[model samples]
Each structure stands twice: as C-alpha cells, then as structure tokens.
Target chain A: MNNSSSVIEPKTRPIRKSKIDYSQGPAPVSVNPAWCKACNICVALCPQGVLEPDAEGKPVVAHADNCIQCGACWAHCPDFAITSNYK
Target chain B: MSIAAKEAGARQDSDVVLRYLRPHVKFPNMWCPGCGNGVVATSLIRAIDKLGIPRDNVVLVSGIGCSSRMPVYLDFQALHTTHGRALAFATGVKFSRPDLKVIVITGDGDCLSIGGNHLIHACRRNIDITTILINNYIYGMTGGQTSPTTPAGAHATTTPFGNTEKQFEACDLARGAGASFIARTTVYHTTQMDRLIMEAIQHRGFSLVEVISNCHTYYGRLNRVGQATQLLRMFQEKASTQPKDPNMVDEDSKDMIQTGIIHRDTEKTELCDEYQKLTDSLAKGKSS
Candidate 1:
C-alpha cells in the first residue's frame, strides 16, 4: 500500500518505554529564597502535597519526607527556585 | 538541630534549574498571573537544562508579543527583536553562527500573520533551529486582537462579532512546510510539554513545538473562559494524543487539540549541516 511508509514510522521508537523514577528518596528539596518570587505553582502542582506555602506565598518544605522527587517544581518554577535531590 | 534551623539550611541550597536562569532577571515578570507563558518559559528552561547545552552555545530569540517576553527572564544570549521577526533574526543568527542552538519564541499573530513567511521558509530549509510558537488564539499583549489561530466563531476584543476565519492548525502547517520535527502540547500538560521540547531541541533539523497556552488577562475575560486555571482545566478536557495512523488524524481528534509529536523526518539533512558538507566538498574539488 502507498501508506505503508507512514504506518511503519511509529515502530521506529520501539517499545522500550523508560519511566522516570520520582521515588528515589531520601530526596531533599533545595530552594533558594532570593530566587523565589513567592509563586505558588510549586505548591499547587506538587503531586504528593509535599510543599506548603508560608504567609509570604513562598513554598516551604512542609513534608520533605513525603516528596516523591517527581521534579514538577524543580522544572516548572518560573524563577527556577527549587531543586530535588535524588540522593 | 531545631526544625526552623534545618528548614533554613535547606532553603540555602541551590537548584540545578536555577543555573540556567539569571539572578538579575527582571520581576515581576511581564506575563499576568495564571498566564500560561510562565509555564512555557519554565518548561523551555528545563528542556535546555536537560539537554546540558552550554549557555554560550544557546541563543533565545523572540518577536514582539506577550509570550516573546520569555527572553528577558533567561540568562541565555537573548534578542527581543521586532514584531513577527524573531524567526527571521534567528535564521540570520543560525546562518552566521551555525554552532549555536537558536530558539524562537513567538505568538499566534506574531508568527502566523506577520512572521508567516519566515515560519514556512524556515521549515522548508530545515534549518537547525527550535521554534516554540505560543498559541493563545489572540494577541494578548495588543489587548486581545484576533490572531490567525483564533477559532471560528471565537470572540476577541477586535472582533465583537464572532470571528468567521478558520483557525490555522500550526502543526499541520509546519508538517506541510517540511519541518523535520513537529509536536503539539498545552501549557497545562507540563510533563509532556517538557519531554516534547527536550526532544525538539535535540532534533537535527528544523523543529517546532506549538504550546497551546491561555491568555487569562484579555482573551480569557473577553471570551468568558473565567481564569487561567479554568482554561487549563478546559485544555485537559479538550487535549488528546494524536493517532499513529495518518488517515485517522482528522477523524479521531476533530473535537480536541491533538498532543504529542505529530510528524518527524529524521533522514532530512539540516540546512547548516548540508551547507558545511557542500563547502567541504567544494574545497576538496578546488584543491584537486
């Protein structure tokens, strides 16, 4: 069939689905307050409810032990304020 | 140590993501609260950071739009050029200094209407530049003018009567124009967006990622989408992964904006790469 080329394109990637490990603990979260703009995106998007915002709207490690290290905050912080240590 | 002291110590530690950003970046950022541009910016930073591309090797170029303000916040060699001309400027940068990784941040109107020529030509040439077109359906910074991607019957400030023009599917346009890598994802789908952008950055030929973001300030208020968060929820409901079957593409995702990589042609040689090979062969021929 003329469409044989397009049909076979998806097969190129193979089925090696590599899942990222978000559960490598004791993963401590590091935050630089100076870089923090008190954006609540980190607190809102946290999958484990690991972060809680203080009165100033800056995220605090309310439950550091519960962090699964998914890196949602580490990658999504507008100010680039947070980091997740997989160690 | 006490709880307060320990928390303070943890706060002092630096983040790897922060290294990509400049500490002296201006704030409060130009994008409004819940405006998806911030998320797009952060996702872009993560993609570049994940690629481990050196700061000196990366150049972020942008046109005049709310989304284009992304360059000001990053530490990359950024150029906030004229409206709808980011791609044109980026092409020049890519041609002159082919060694650098060039990225173009543009908006719906900025790219499609004004910079439309640049977009299509860039794809046709298959230049080694990664372009992220932030589509919000309206010209948010220009106070909600109807852009080329504004859906049929959608309301904007400039269009009190619902827009009758058909929306341009950006991914389809890029694909038709011969871009090597083309992906579509929304701002709310940060994880998928992150991965797609990372893949786009690493792709050899011309690449594009159209991030369907929300303009809560102007487009949201005028169109009654409520706020940024509500628009994000709507995106979640309306977005879906594209089907592998090329024929099922239109039929399967008629009601939704299809996400994920829609098209990729890995065999196509990049503009700079081809140029280098041509020059190398020419030099050899002359010597012979």
Candidate 2:
C-alpha cells in the first residue's frame, strides 16, 4: 500500500467531446488544394471511404454522407489540408 | 439564422491551427508529403493554443536536422542554432529570462549522437526547459544513416547488413540523467502526444518528451515499409500503453515501446530558481 501514494494519476478533463453536433446531420469535409500535396493519406485513412482520389491523386469529398465526422482524416492529414466543419 | 450568418459560421471552422502560424511561411512546408514532422508540429500548435500561452512569451530553439526546421514554419521567438547544441542555447535563454518558456526541437542524430553530452548535462541541471526530441531512428536529412537510437536489426545506409548495436532507450536515458519529467508517445498517438506535450510544458523542472515520428521518405523506403500510413499503423500495433522496465529483458514485450509518462520527480530543484536565491543571499550579505 506504500506504493499507492507514489502512483501518478491521469488528469481529469471536462467531459464535453466533439465540437460538431451530430444530431444536426453529417458535417461538411473540405480539402484545401493550396496546402494539399496530394499525399493520399486522408483518402487511405477515411474509415467510411468518404474521400476519393481524383486523376492527380488529390483527395476529393466523394461521399459526404459516409462521413461520421470522427476526425481521423483531420488529425492524420500531414499537410493540414483537411478540415471538418465544427460550426 | 440567415444564409449569410451560416456561411460566416462555416468560414470560422476552417482550421484553428492556422492562427498560430506565420502568415508568410509558405504552403505545404519543406518536409516530404507524408512526413510525421508536420503532424507533430500540428499537435504542438494545438497544445500551445490550449495552454493559452502568449506567442511572445514562448521561445523555440533548434539544432540542424529535419526536425530542427520546425522553427521556420512555427511563429515564435525562434533560434536555429548549430548542430547538437540546441539544449545548450536553450539553457542560456532560460537562465537570462526565467519568465519565458523555452522549447528545444531536435532529431535522433542531433540529440543522441553529437548532442549527447548536452542532453545529459541539461537533464542533470534540471533547468525549466521543455525538449521535444523527434526520434525517427535514422538520419533522414543525411540519407538514412543509422543513429544511436536505431534498433539492432534495423537497416540503414551506413549499416546495410543490419545495425549491430543495441538501441538507446531515450526515456530511460533521460530518467537516468536526472530529468524531472519524462514522457514518450508516437505520432500515431495524436491525443496522447497533445496531452503529454501540454503536461511537459506545465512541469516546473526539466521535461523531455521523445516523439517517435516517421521518416517515410527515407526510413520507410530503406526498410521496405509501404508508406507513412503503413508506418503509423505499425506504431499503433507495436506500442504499448503500459509502462515497462527499460532494463529488463522481457520476451513478451521485447518489440514494444511504452507510451505515457515514464518518470517524474517534482521535488528536484530547478537551476535558475536556485541561482536567483544564491544571488539574493550574496547581495544581503554584502549589505550586512
């Protein structure tokens, strides 16, 4: 029991999660072409196949309905090109 | 609400990370398309934003390497110093101005090899500086040379047959050197990376967060790993959340690296604070 006092505890955070209200339907996913280098990472990582690569390997929002707005693509985009509308 | 108000609301949702970047730092950055450095930089910006630290009060110092190029893209008081001396320069900055938060961004070769002495002494001094050592295992900038942290069986340009030396566990090295706080997380663990960086910054003494990033352009191609996505998936599969003894030679978790805080000691004295006390006592004795 002496070790109990020394054990580190994970900090508690506010329970609120996700800025997008899912009840309002799926949010829009936009890709900024200027910043995008056509890495195909967002297309490969989209869990629902919401994004598809066009002729030049650039990611295009092909199936917006499939987007759960889980932010996997948003968080993994190496170029910071993808953004899920939080408003 | 009118369509105009809705459009305004949507525009604001573009990207919260852009507010932290300099307006003129070019698009797409200098790293390879799927390099993990970009992802690490994004997490860092988000962490800084969450802390609400004023941009002017933060200083970013770096030494020459792919990871050291971070200061060029990030909008902060930046200094791109010589190779392997980022921590030395950062220590000077902390001593002169104790009010600012100094962060050092370095790579595997820069921190563990040439800068090895500085790393140990900085940890020993326990100064209030946060170091983010991005360990991608190989020297990506110099064409995939095997670094000190590269695994024994891993292949690099310098060691095509296979690296024969045992890897340096960076977190254990920091702990042994007397760092007050130490944490490790991969680029695959974005949320954990953000939380650990925030915690490391808030810690009162010397804090080290070794970020295991992907150098897909060099490390991945040399090792026959598919791409950045595949490398990230490998990290997700290989890393364990539980803490393990670095010294132990466990067979079950031999391939796994621990994520989360590895060690912490808050009672250790910070160098600058102790120096201030010494100066105060000296002045009082002179007056008496």
Candidate 3:
C-alpha cells in the first residue's frame, strides 16, 4: 500500500541576500510642515526619540537611525503631518 | 542616509491617505491640533483600506459636530445632515440601496443628546448601518459644553463646578437598545480601533463603534487634562481590554474605559433585508 504519488518531495532553495540594505532600517519619518499643526504629539509619543520639535514646534527627524519604525509617531499624529515611505 | 532614504524623505509631501480625502477640500482641517478626531478619521481610513472597499460604494452620513465634519473631508458620497439626525439619514440611504455601505459619524452631543431617539430606534430595528459615535465628553464645536457622556464631576463650560449627573455609558445603551454589534475604542488604541471599526462595518446588523476621542482645545483646557498627548497617555493607562462587570458600580468603573467588542449578536435580522422581504412577499401576493 505505497502512496508515493500522493506525497511530493520538499525542495531546498538556495538562500540569497536581497539588494536592499537591511541596516538602514525603515524609511526616515517625514513631517509635512505645511499640514503640521505643531501638535508636538509625534515628538512626545515617539518611543525611540526619533522626532524632535523645531523652532515652530513642528516635528523633525532628529535621530533617523534610532527609528525602530514602530509607526507610533505617524499613527498618533492628529494632523497627518508624519509619513514614512516604509509605512 | 542612502539614496533610498533621501527619496523617502523627499516623497514625504505625498501622504498615503491623502488619496482617500476630497481634493477640493483644503488641507489642515478645522479641528484643533492634537485633536483625537483626526486619529479616528485616520484609523477609519486604514480600516477601509484594509477591507478594500471602494470609495464609490461608501456613503458617509454625518450630523452637526466636530466629529460629524469627517464626511466632508473624505472622498465619498457624503451627506452632512442636521444635528443628531445622521443615523436617520444613514438609515434612509441604506434602505434605498442595500449595496452601498452607509456609515454615520456623530459626536457625543449630536448622537446621545440630539439624536438619542434615532439611535435607540435604529438599534431596535437592527439596521445594517455602522455608526461611529465619537465621544469627546464635551461639545467641542460650540465651546465645550457638557455632553451626555461627560464623566460625572468633570468640568465643562456648562459644568464649571463639575457635572452633577452620571455619565452615560454609550456601549451599554447600544447593547440595551438591541444593536447586534457594540464596541468601544479610544484614539490611544489605534490598532484596536482600526480592527473594531472594520468588524463593525462588516457586521450584518446595526453596529455601533464608540470612539472615545479627546477635544484638546476645549475639553482639555476646561478640564485641565493637559495637552492631547497627556490625554492620550491617560487613555493608554486607564483603558482596560476587559469589559466592565455588569454589576460593577459607577465608582469602581469610573476610571476605566472599556476597549474592544462588548456585545455581538449576529443571528438577529437586519432591518433593510427584513423590509425587502416584506415588500417582495406583498408584490408576489399582488401578482399571484
């Protein structure tokens, strides 16, 4: 009672490195000043301290490398001022 | 930063959700900075995107209030009706075209006070409409007056000495009125909000998703709840995923805002479908 036809052998594919660099992390958080209401919410809620308020209180990406890309800043931004290409 | 990073930063001007908004409408909405209404609107757009519901198939009906103004900005068939009448208008839309998804955006004042009757009746009928009641606790647009959902002992312009009456539990009210689906989420819980809104929209019977939003400009200043961030943090700290015990006293549940679906009854009949069946039966009898 051999059922060889019913089961297929698993194939092992070669592992390859992707062209995109994994070290850079996700895209830098971009704040649109035109729409920014200077809420400072993104700056306040960012866990990584990636965003900081400018002279006018608008958020700017101060530590782009520290960004874990958790999306807390953009998700919490009430004015829709924060955006990331990776999001 | 690499070339990709540079390009990402350069492309920040174009927002992913901007396509969901009306092009003619101006940027920088009228809501105050850090207002929770924006968070709710964004979460709603995300939910709609995840569901892949076409913009044309959606009809947003809103009554007069800050939250009600959401329909105006979104690029969909919208009707900004009079105060507290958003649910009634949405019911008519759903009845006429069952294919079109009707969503009502109403605020605490407009929904519970002005349109409370319509809300209960809609729930009783079990209409296939989604109502997103934004409970900001105060009338934000009209200068921070006390609303039905305003917590007792909370300060508002009308309740300067603190509200003497008990706060209305919106989810409990909806459940009692026979809504098939009743859920509550706050702006602080963005992920939960998006999921609950999507679930409510997909539900067949009357569904109500009460979004506990913050009115920073008025409610925050009046109540000294700090800025929007502080208020959102408060939500994060106080919101419990566990539903409040039915027997829990007001004092015990006062500080806790329940987050997640509280009640769901899918077996009940939908108003529009039932009405259609009745009409079809009558027409068949007449023809026979």
Candidate 4:
C-alpha cells in the first residue's frame, strides 16, 4: 500500500535521488522515488550492495563508488524506479 | 526538437521500465510485495526494445493468471483473452497477420493445466509465435492452488499435505511436442532472461521460454521460502548454467535449475513457410 500517489509526502526533499552520470558514462545510477514501490528488489538483487533503503524505504545510492552499472538494479526493478545508463 | 532528437533524449535518461511501459498503466502493479512477475515483465519489454521493432509491430496476448496481467501495462497491441485460451487466440492472430510479432504470455496453471492442449498443438504446428510462459510453480491468481508444475512435496492451499503429483517439465514438453526453440531462464538472472526472450522472438518457428518466477505470497510462505528476496537468493544459489545432459531434470534433487537455450532445431520448416510453399506451387501450376 506504500506507493507514490496514496502515500503522503514529508514536505521537504525526497531522500532518494539519482546521481546519474549519463553525460560521462555508466558508473552512476539514479532512483525515481515517486515510481519506486520500495519493494527493495533492486537492493536485494544488487551483487555489489551499491544501493540501500532510505528512510522512506526507497532505494538510495549507498555506495555510488561501488556501482558497476551492470544494470541488475535497472533491469530487475518492476516499477521503473531506478535508471542506469549502462552502455 | 526533431523526432529523432526527442527519442534520443528519452533514451538518454529514462529507465527501461519507463521507456517501454505504457504511459496509461496504473501506478502500482497488482502483484504482491516482491513478486517475480514484475522482473519478468521488464525483461520482456527490454527485449522488445533491444530488437529495434516498432511497438506497433508487436502484439502481446495472454490467458488469465497473475503473469497474464502484463498486457494491461505493456504498450502494445494487446489481447487479454479468456482463461486458458491465449495460445489459441494468438495462433489465429499470428496466422491471419503473419507480419505482426505475436507473443503469448501465460502462467503455469493457465498454459500447462487448462491450456495444455493448445500449447502442445501450437508447438506441434511449429507456428511462428513466441511463448513466454511464466512458471511460478503454483496458481497465484486463484488463491495459490497447487498447479501441474508444482514440485512434489511443495505446499499449496489445495495440497496442504504437500503435493503428491510429479511436476511438469515445460521445456521437455515443448521439445517433445515440436517447439523449434526451447529455453529456460529466471527472474534472478535478469540479463539472461532478457537475451533469451529476444532470441525467442527472433526464432523462425514456435519458441518457448520458461521463466522460473516466484510466488512469494503463497508458494513461498507455504513452502517455507522466507520472502521474495530470499526466494530470489535461493535462485541465485540454486540455478546452474553448466553443461548438463538436457534429458536430466531431477525435480527430486537440489540441483540448480537449468537456465539457457536447451533446444533449437532450425532445419525444420516452419508452418508459415510450408504454407507459402504450397501457395507458390499452386500459382506455378495454374500458370503452366
């Protein structure tokens, strides 16, 4: 039941945001907090554990340096919540 | 901006789920908390996106089941037919308009149990239709009843004593019934699943890709798998791609479930090809 529309906002910044480096390369990733169901499937499937749950349970880039951008998170996300520019 | 530049802009940043999913699809999918169905659906759309085919060229058809709910979200020419009739309808659609790329999405119970006959015959005909059969091992939509593919000793509401029946070997059934391409993949292996679906789409004849998905809400709880993530972890641990005898599928053993292209016979002429040949011969005879 904790989805985008029905869930209320904190009136501040969404903790989970993208650090997308598409202009440069495929190493960095981003999270669309509104689209994320907070299922954490991307978190669980990440081989590097590069992402971790934020306060609202949405996945945030916990270790941006560790992200290999193999696209496990991007492909496995059912909600289209995470975007990775893995060339 | 020009159309090409606009398309490139969307591609430069949008996640694949956003790039491929129908804009009108509901915010949250109806599947359970961590259902593997979403992963499979994303894998499929990603495959279509990779193939460079226009969305208008694709037709997604499905029978009733949790996995079949995919068409409602996919932006394609879709037909959500009655329960157990997807393949039959897809066969007609593919035959009547062979130019369209037809893909049938069905679940364990929908395709293997009630729609078993259509599946077998479709394979036998070697029709040019790709079947992405999502096997969650139990009927997730109808309250998690034991399905034909449920492994022995697995628990379901209908099989509280644990399932006594043998599980159905999906790829083997298709191989025997004459599917030209047979492959298997899992939601855990996202990349591989995407590649397999693409190959299935490209294959000239009947193709079947058995996606080993999880029903965490029911099959997992009753069978003692902790949650969707735990079940996926189990897949990561249990799946094996090493070359094993294709004939060996020991359901009783804890061996990694085989994941890859298990069978492909391209020499066999596809049904449409044969039909075209027949028409050609008739036309030649008339001219003579």
Candidate 5:
C-alpha cells in the first residue's frame, strides 16, 4: 500500500533576495504626520524595526530598507496616518 | 563597502537557488497568463523557504479549483483531493502524522459554498493546519459562476443580473469559528502575503489566510476590471487597513470593506493538543 505518508522534498531551491529594490532606500509610507498623535503603536508593533521615534517622539522611518511591507504598522496605527505604495 | 565587492556579492547570491526546494520540481506553472494563483503559489513557496521547514516534513493538500493545482506544481508530498474535501483529508493527514506540516489550498466555491461544513468544523476544532483560501470571487475553472465570497452586485454566469446575496468574509468567518490565526491579503501585496503565510504556518492551531486573488479571465471581465493590471490596481486602491471597530467606516475609502489581518489569537489549544490531553487523562484514569 502506498501509504499517503511518504515524505517528499522540494524539487528546486529558491534564491534569497528581496523582490523590491531595497537599495533605493525605504519606500515612502504615505502618512499624514499631523494626524499622528505619537501613539507609538506603529513603532512598538513593527516586526521589521522599520519605524523609530523622532526628536518630538513622533514615529518616523528609521530603517526603511528592512520594511517587508507587511502593513502591520499601518493596520495597527489608530490614527490612520500610515499607508503604503504597492505600485 | 566597495562597489566591486558589492557587485560580486550580488552576482554570487543571484545564482544560488533556495536550499529548501526539492530540486526535482520544475518551474513555469500551468496556470493561465494572468491567473493570480501563480502569485499566491510563489508566496507559499517563498514562505516555506523563509521558514526553512524541510520540504519532506510538509504536506500540501488542495481541492478542485485553479488554486488547487498548486500541489501539483510544487515538489512536495501533495494530495490533490476531491472537490470541497481538502480540509477533511488534511484533518486525517495531520492527526495521523503530527510531525508533518499540513497546508490546505482551497478556492472560495470549493471551500465556503461546498465545503462550508468542513471549514467551520476545522476552525471550531482548532485543527493544526494552515489553510490558504484563494478567493478570486468566482468559479474560474467551471466558467464564471458566482461564489460565496463574490461581492454583492458582482456579475457572474449565474448572477449576470448582478449578485444580490451578501459575500462571506472568510477571515471573519474563521475568526468567529474559533480559528487561532486569521489573515487577509491580496495578490497585489506579494511581500505581505509571504509574511502572513509564514506567520500562519508557525501558528500552533488552525490558521486561515483569505487571499483575495485576481481572475482576469472570467471574474475580471465580468466585473469590468478586464485587464490583470487593472484588477491588481483596483485591489491596491480599494483594500485598506482593518479598522479597530469592525463597524467603523473609512471616510476616504471608496469601498466599505477593509483588508489585512483582521484577527489573530494564539492562546487557544489546538485540536491535536486537546486530543492528546484527553487520551492522557483516560489512560491515567484507567491505571488509577
């Protein structure tokens, strides 16, 4: 009986590279800074460490290159200040 | 770093194939030119790559649909089962071989409409499987027919007059049914799709990814978003963040609904975990 339990391996190995041009710097996250109340939710929740606090404690893109464009920061931001350019 | 050194590094890395791939599976999938299933398939493969989960330890299961062809293309232990029974089959597979990572690729019609019972029970039981529901909003394989996730007033073979029934939000339904991880992403956002799939796979209990895909051949033509590019553009524009209150409307949004991971809770016990506990208790009682 060919038990459906046989283990199979991936036929091809994929290369590790960012699909987007990260060298071009962080893609700008469209934000209305004025609407941002510095809740810091974006900074705290960002898994990629993309956001950082400015001198006024406002969230800014500290490491845009690392942003995987997961949208977690944008989704969690209460103020609706963050958006991304999928284009 | 020097420019020459950087260029050399890039060249070296570019040629190296992913270590996780099985090497026997060939490229150039069977999906049509504009089918979004290819994109979703790539994202799943990429997620598998990122996690470095041994290909031998993962099992891909699917039902009848364009997306269901995913298992055939990927070099893995795949079960292309009957229409609307992928979850049921996957449940059996996971319970029997707990060591293997099981993933279910189902279409809206195949899953929600026909396999709704299995989907509901899978969530309620908190099965340890990752389900990627590719919702192109219509039955692409059997011509353009209305699906459970087809937006209200959308055109389809059966709903040429414009569908009047409400759509099923798969992620919301999964969350309501007690799924541990629920995420929603579109084919336009490939990077986010990859991240979400990786996270969902790592989650302990049942994980659902309601991937809004584009069916340019049928669904797009019927919906008036004719071209693949147009459908992708529309998804980018209309899809917004899930609001804190499900009822809260986005004032600037043209469409009332939102996208992105709507809900995720990891504290719940998985079906396998609970089952093990029950068996252990029974054994202890018998011994005592």
Candidate 6:
C-alpha cells in the first residue's frame, strides 16, 4: 500500500508437457498369455528396456522395438509364454 | 646402388630366404563344410599372432572332436591327443614347461562331457593356459548324439523325443569353477571372437572362452535346421545382452538374449603366480 510499491513482479509461466508417440515404441512380439505364469523372469533379464510390469506384476512388452532377439529369455523361461516371429 | 634398387632386390629374394614355415601337424581337417571350427581356429591364430610368442615357445593341444583338429592346422608345436584328454595333456605341458604358452582346443562333448573333470581341476589350479571350448550342441563327429550343452527339449540322436536334461552353461560353469577370465562368443561374431581370444591368451591366469559354433551336417540335420546360415540366424535372433536386474525380466519374453562377453575379472592371483611364490619361499628357507 506504500507509495514505493511501483516495482512490477516477474511473470511465472507453467511448464508445457511434450506429447508421447506410442507408435514409435517397439513392435510387440507374439505372447501366449495362457502360458504365462507372471513370474517376470524375462522382465529382469531383458538387456533392452523393452518390458515392463503390469498391475498384477505380469510382464508386459512395453517397448518391443528395443528387443534384440537374443534367446536368453526363451532359454531361461521355465514356461514357454514368449515366442518371437522372425521378420 | 640406390636404396630403392636394394629394397626391390631384397623383396624379390625374400621368397627364397629360408623360413621355418611348416604345419604343426598334418591336416586332412575333419571338420565339415560351414562348421564354425575354422572361425575358432582363425581366432586362435590371430591370438597367437598378437601375443608374438615364439612358435617354439607355444604348444597347441587338442582332443578328439571336429574342432579338435585345430592343432593340426596351426604351425606351432602341437599335440593331437586322445579323446577327452586335451586339458589333462595341456596341464602337463604348462607345468612341465612353464615358459611355454599352452592352449587347449576342444568341442562341447569333448570338453564338458568327458574332459569336464580336467577342465574343472585346471580352473581350480588356475593354470597359466588358455582353453577354447567350441560348443556346437551336438556330437558332430559321432553322428549327432546329445551333448551336455544341447538345449533342453531339443532333439538329438540319443534323445529323439527331445533332450530332457538341462543344458550346462559353459561360461557359468567356468566362472563357478574359478576360471580367472571367462568370456562367451559365437562364431558369427568374428570381430568380438578374435578380440576375446587374443585377450584370453594375453591374460596370465587360466582363461576359458566358450565359442558357440555351428555343426551343420549333424546338429543341423538332427535339429531339423537345414543349414549353417539358419543356425547362425537363430543365434542372431535368440542371443541378447544380460539385463540390468535379473528380476525385472519378463515372464512372457524369455527367449531373447544376445551373445557377448559375460564375465571378466583381472584382480585374482594366477595359479602359476601362487606356485612361484610357494617355490620362492621354499628356496629361501632351504638357503637359510
């Protein structure tokens, strides 16, 4: 309220969010959900960050594009849920 | 005479110069066409070249297998020993002539199935030698029999219903057996294979490099995979790098892992170093 309040404050702007494109993600390899036990062994062994956990802790191929197709996941899996299709 | 004229004359006469170029042993190579044994042999040669060890100071040993014929093709001092005894012979050679660089070339069945005891003891003792295990999944020389490394549920001559026994991971076994330097590479990855073999030879302690090779005639036919290229394609498709956390692996996608160096540790004391230390102390005591 004083007469010395002539200084103006700097304006603060809100940060903008960038749009994400799901189409750019990895292609999904065929998964036999029926055979899956949700053990998540493939999730931990994937060198590429292509897999993620779902709400029930089941493995979900979140980034299939990152898969290099080394058969460690297939060889290590006790149950055969994941199968790769050679393009 | 001008310098260029002298150099040209020397180059022209170089072919006539006496050079000790001879086969280590005669070779009517037993390996089949498109087999990965050639690649493994090339890697071993490149390793020997890089080390620059005198030909007389190196002894190449091999057991009976398709890949075992490597020593026959090399120019170094060599021994084509009995089946499943290459490691045992190599151990004797290393201990007897500690000055020599000893190398053992063997296949999956030859090394893991029969020579496994020798291999474990060699690793346990940490002998100053390099061992290359060419894992081709089937016993190629013996008509496609099941090997210790044949994948579970995979067909073999002995296991027509598919192999029920679990396959042994060679690198893991070597690591567990106390091999100082352990690496795994496939024949398809020649660049990495050459580099890894060279590094293994240069390493002071016991080193083991598991070379996953293809046995087209036997293993391929038994497995219903027609050709070497198909098997190589499978390797390219199935192998992947190790994950950051083994626990974060997907349950569904368990077949994709790449081929590369899996483990390497340079800090451990070599077996020969320990032996020297013990001998030195004993000599000091005796002198006193």
Predictions in order: lDDT: 0.78, 0.83, 0.83, 0.82, 0.74, 0.69
Ordering by DockQ: 4, 2, 3, 1, 5, 6
* DockQ, all candidates in order: 0.12, 0.24, 0.22, 0.27, 0.02, 0.01
Share of native C-alpha contacts between chains A and B (below 8 angstroms) recovered by candidate 6 = 0.00
RMSD of candidate 5 to the truth, in angstroms, is 14.8
Tell me how candidate 4 scores on lDDT: 0.82
Q: Over the stretch B1-288, how does candidate 3's per-residue lDDT look in tens digits?
A: 865675576453326577688888898999888889888888888888779899999999999999988987888889999999999888889988999999999999999998999999999999999999999899999988989988889899998999999988888998999999999999999889989999999999999999998887778888887777778877887899886677877774757888899999989999888888999999999999
What does the lDDT read for residue A13 in candidate 1? 26
lDDT per residue (tens digit) for residues B33-124 in model 1: 55678778878876777778988899999999888888888889998999898999999999999989999999999999999999999999
Candidate 5 per-residue lDDT, tens place, B1-288, comes to 554455454432211123333456653444554467766765777688768888889899999988898777677789999999999999999999988999999999999999999999999999899999999999999999888988888999899899999988787788888998888888777778889999999999999998888887788888877555466657877777756454656654535346667778778888888888999999999999
lDDT of 5 by residue, A31-79 (tens): 5566555545456545566677666656777766666555555544433
Query: TM-scores, in order shown?
Result: 0.79, 0.88, 0.88, 0.86, 0.71, 0.68
Taking all chains together, the TM-score of candidate 4 against the true structure is 0.86
Worst 10 residues of 2 chain B by lDDT: B5-14
Q: How many pairs in model 5 have backbone atoms within 3 A of each other, for residues 3 or more apart or on separate chains, i.e. clashes? A: 10
Query: lDDT per residue, candidate 4, B1-288, as tens digits?
Result: 653464466564336557677877776778776688888888888789888899999999999999999999888899999998999999999888989999999999999999999999999999999999999899998898999999888899999999999999998899999999999988899889989999999999999999999887898889888667777877877788865565866853445688899999999888888888999999999999
What tens digits encode model 3's per-residue C-alpha lDDT throughout A39-84? 7777767666667666777777776666656678777777777787
* Model 5 ranges off by over 4 Å: A1-87, B1-27, B244-257
Q: After superposing candidate 3 on the true structure, give the runs of residues whose Cα lies further than 4 Å from its correct spot.
A: A1-27, B1-14, B246-253
Q: Which of the predicted structures, 4 or 6, would earn the higher lDDT when compared with the native?
A: 4
